[model samples]
Target: MTLSVQLRHGGPPLDFAADFPDGRITALVGPSGSGKTSILRAIAGLLPVRQAHVALGTEIWAEGNIHRPTRERSIGFVSQHYGLFPHLTVQANVETALIHLPIGERRKRALHCLALAHVEGLERRYPDELSGGQKQRVALARAIARQPQVLLLDEPFSAVDRSTRKRLYIELLRLHEQLAATVLLVTHDLDEAAQLASHLLLLRHGRIVQSGATSEVLTRPTSEEAARLLDIPNIFTARVDGTASGRNLRLRWGPHALRATGPLPAGIEGDLRWAILPSNVLLVRPDKPWGSHLENPLLVIVEEVIEMGTEAVVRLQPQGLSEARLQMRLPVRAVHRYGIAVGREVTVSLRAGDIVPLHTGPAR
Candidate 1:
């Protein structure tokens, strides 16, 4: 099951074509001003995508001589600011989507959905009486109340704080299994994108940069733009020293030698750039016994530390690359046990499997 969409517009020109699969959450993500929202609106029939052809499974929603109005299409939309209507009670707002439900069944279904969304006690309250998380749940219940064929979420969890947002995401996953509806979720958050999406479509400048399974797209990007959008850190210029299959990449960061995983890009053996994530780098105490051999040894100074409940984020200033800083997220307990403190000197270790070589450019 798939929803195939092809779009074209006049001007400097805007065009894109995508096929969203059914029964799974597909995320459409991009940087600011990337036309992600416009594409969402087009699918909801709120905005027009001229010359656009849209088909859902066996149904033809839009094409030559076939245009279905928004009402005729069974779709549920949950926008960012949505909640129970301030005037209507939570139950009423949620059940409002049931325009054709039998009178007796409507309220019962609404209550069931509210309970499923974990807001059973909040049915009598209005939007103003609920917290941000509660309101988002209510919005969710409202959207799913009528059991629409498709669901559209536009940054629905962005309004809440980080912890609450994560909880809501967990709730969303639970609901996803219970409903198993075709979901098209839009968000600017990379972490949220990584967690909630089964398939990811990276959009940029009113176009699609890449689209594939979440793991594939996130781990292996197609271009420098896609890599940058994925936020892979510590990218640097490099060259292919030797090779066996996809290995033997020789790269350096401010005089520090490095290696990478996977095949080096074609024609980029000499003078190319590579990237690595900070989370992949391990830090050992400076006074610890030295290992027999290491590819690259970096003498880094601790710059800052941020405690976030179970996790801690550490920023560092490397010896060779004082201009380019590094950031790592680790467990709070690790820092406590190791007695890690700001201004301390430590040696960071890089594993061959951790480095992901990217296109040549200035990695920021």
Candidate 2:
């Protein structure tokens, strides 16, 4: 199924086309108001668009003048808030989706779905009586009771605790494999998207900035907006002082010089935006000399270290330069072994290959 959308409702229009492979999970990821949920709603026909087209293997659910209602579209939508009725038990909620069937068939279908969602034992419990994860399971089970061709999940795990959410991720993956329904998940959590989605769509301000395989999109963001939204912190605006047919240009950031690779327009000079992931920031051994001794190594003062489980986010202030504060994500084991702490001087390296040029500006 390929979902092509162009929508406008007195706001910035959304105009982007993407294909959701049949029976595969595709995540719509972006910051709030980026139209992630709107896109899902549009697909479900709950939110009509000025111009939209949805096709599932040659069957058009929606198109110009041929719009299908939400129920007719046959999409199972699980909202972020877990729209489970407080008064209804888990079994009743699942059975509600199958009301069109006979009473006996509804009970059978609900039980099947509950088992598939791994919440079979909680069938008699009300929404309030269940844990956050259990409530989500009931919601998912209810959504799938209809056996819809497409499943739309709008941040279904966002409300749960981290540990609970992790468990749900595995459960969802299991259910996805068992059900084999095409899924479109709306979420702002990139890690969640990367973990569960085989494909990714990057949305921004009602536009599809990029879409591709999960690994490819994360490793190679197409623009500054994409990189920034991905939470990549090592972005910089460097003046291009030299170039060789737009390959390996010499760039200057503050008083520091660095090398950049990739094709740019010939004679492309002046300031250009570049970014690198914090994980790529390497620490130079103290035994080695800094400066001209290494290609991109720079002496920096450790301003702060934020412990994050097994890894730490270390803020490095480059010495003898006016560059912005840089952050490096290093293993806690390495940090402790090297006795790295606040105010300690250390050498850090950013490989030229790691520094990616953005298709956007240098916002000087």
Candidate 3:
């Protein structure tokens, strides 16, 4: 399956394009009003595209002049609210979509779909009688009753509680394993996208900011905007001052100078930005003797500590720097072990390999 779309509309332009393979989930994620849902609507034929090309498994679903209607696209779409008929029972809601088949066949298929959705016992319950999770499952069963070639989900689990959402995530994964349909999910939660999707398309201002495998995009973003959008911690602006020992490069940031392991890129000089994840920041004790360390240890004042079960986020500010702060996620036990708290002095080290150079530009 391949989807190539280019849309130009009023306000921020949607110059978005990407290709999704068969039987894999591609998540469309970004901030609110970033056109993530707009792209999904266009793919489902709910919105018109000024210029586009879309295909699914050797069939021409849409092109510049020839556009297929929503029904003809043979896609199953689940909206945020789990759009179900309040008057119809769970069984009847699913059976309605299978009305094209014979009467007995329709009943059999509807029952089978209910079984697949784990809602077989609640077939006679109406939409208002079922819980949020059950209603979502019923809606899903109805959408998949006809066996669509593609499935589009726009924050389908947002209406449910957190625990219910996690359960639905596992259910969706099992359903995908059985059905093997090309799935496109839209969500504003990056953690949800990382947990559920195999590939990710980061959208911003109605355009695709980054697209790649979930692991790659989450770890190694290409630019500063991408890193910021990904919520990467400890982003500092620095300049490549000169070369260091054994092909290492030196960088100057604020009142501190640091060494980078790799050689500087050819023809690159002047100011640059570097980012390190919170998990990569190492903690050192100020009272400990200084060994032959590669980089200088930073003296910082602990500003805040937030405990969240297994881990704690320690916010620190460099002692003499005016506008520099670093965050580290340490184990909860370690926080107490080292006596980390507000207004305490501590030493921290950032390895050269953990720092990645980032380019800056308007995300598109």
Candidate 4:
């Protein structure tokens, strides 16, 4: 089924268009207060649509008299806090939505959901007694017990620790595939959006500024406004160098010169800013292939290296007077094995294929 939702209370408006394509996870990604939650409420009939319409398949929830109440809509929503009842047992919370069902069926369905959520043994546990991850799983169990036609998640892993959050993300993806659930998940996390969604929608100021295939939106976003919202680091200013209908730009960051694939707008050639990602940069021996889309190559000095468990973030201070600091994530092992320390020189290649030109600003 396809869902198109548009809503605005005051100030700016928010719009989202995408299909709940069968057996795929579609994510609604943006910064905080960007109308992600409002979209959820509007779709569930819990919020009023000011000047927009919401359509789910042939049913129009925000148009005409076709509105379906939250209880009537077959949607299972899981919020960031995992709103499980404090006084209720795990099984009770999971089975709460199934109140209309007979006792036997309700218990059966609840247990099945708990098993899928990997909370089977915690059936007798209370919300307060459960860990953050466990509570979220129970919240998911409750959602799936409703046998919802659509699943809506709102930053479900945000409250947990980094380790638990990663595990939960994997589990969520597995569950989505196992059930073939149509999902519309809301997150302020870029990594979550990149890893979880097949399609991405970047919202800002309550408007859906950009939406497309995850890579397309991330790399070649539609607007400067949308680029700022993606939190893309190291976006540089540059101009088109060659004649591909201005479909190329010569960007200069600090003393580093780079090339971009898209046509630079008029007056932006050599005088405008370009966008690059720290993570997109490759730090290695200068002899290694610089991938396919090669751009500016820099022999940078490792100014600082932060060992962040699984990954090490290396800060590179490029040559010359350009006051730009380039950062790249390398595995912990790579940092340790290379004896890559502060003041060590490394050749970092900022390839064109890795370039995502988003005007001249970082993604918010």
Which portions of model 3 show Cα errors greater than 4 Å?
242-249, 261-267, 285-296
lDDT, candidate 4, 131-189, per-residue tens: 99999999999998887878889889889999998899899989987877778889888
Q: If ranked by lDDT, best first, what sequence of candidates would result?
A: 2, 3, 1, 4
Report how far residue 126 has shifted in candidate 1, in Å: 3.3
The 0-to-1 C-alpha lDDT of every candidate, in the order given, reads 0.79, 0.84, 0.83, 0.76
Query: How do all the candidates rank in terms of TM-score, highest first?
Result: 3, 2, 1, 4
Best-fitting candidate, measured by TM-score? 3
True-structure lDDT of candidate 3: 0.83
Model 2 TM-score relative to the real fold: 0.89
lDDT of 3 by residue, 1-364 (tens): 5654556655445787778877899898888899988887888888886776777767776786788888788788898988898888889989888878999999899999889988888988899999999999998998899899789999999999999999999999999999999899999888899899999988888888888898777866767888988898788888888765555768887767787765344454788887878988888854567786746567888899999998999999986776788999999998998899999988888788677677677544
- Residue-level lDDT of model 1, residues 1-364, one tens digit each, is 6777887765324577888888899998988777776776677777776677877888888787778887677688898798357899999998788867887899999999899999998888988999999999999998888787788998998899999998999999999999988899988887788899999888877788878998877876656777788887655555556554555566656677776666556665556655567676687755568775764667888899999999898888888676877777779988888877899887787777666666543222
Judged by lDDT against the true structure, how good is candidate 2? 0.84
Worst 10 residues of 3 by lDDT: 260-269
For model 3, state the Cα shift of residue 182 in Å: 1.6
Candidate topping lDDT: 2
Rate residue 312 of model 3 by lDDT.
Answer: 99
Which model, 1 or 4, shows the larger lDDT?
1
Residue 83 error for model 4, in Å? 2.1
**TM-scores of the models, in the order given:** 0.83, 0.89, 0.90, 0.82
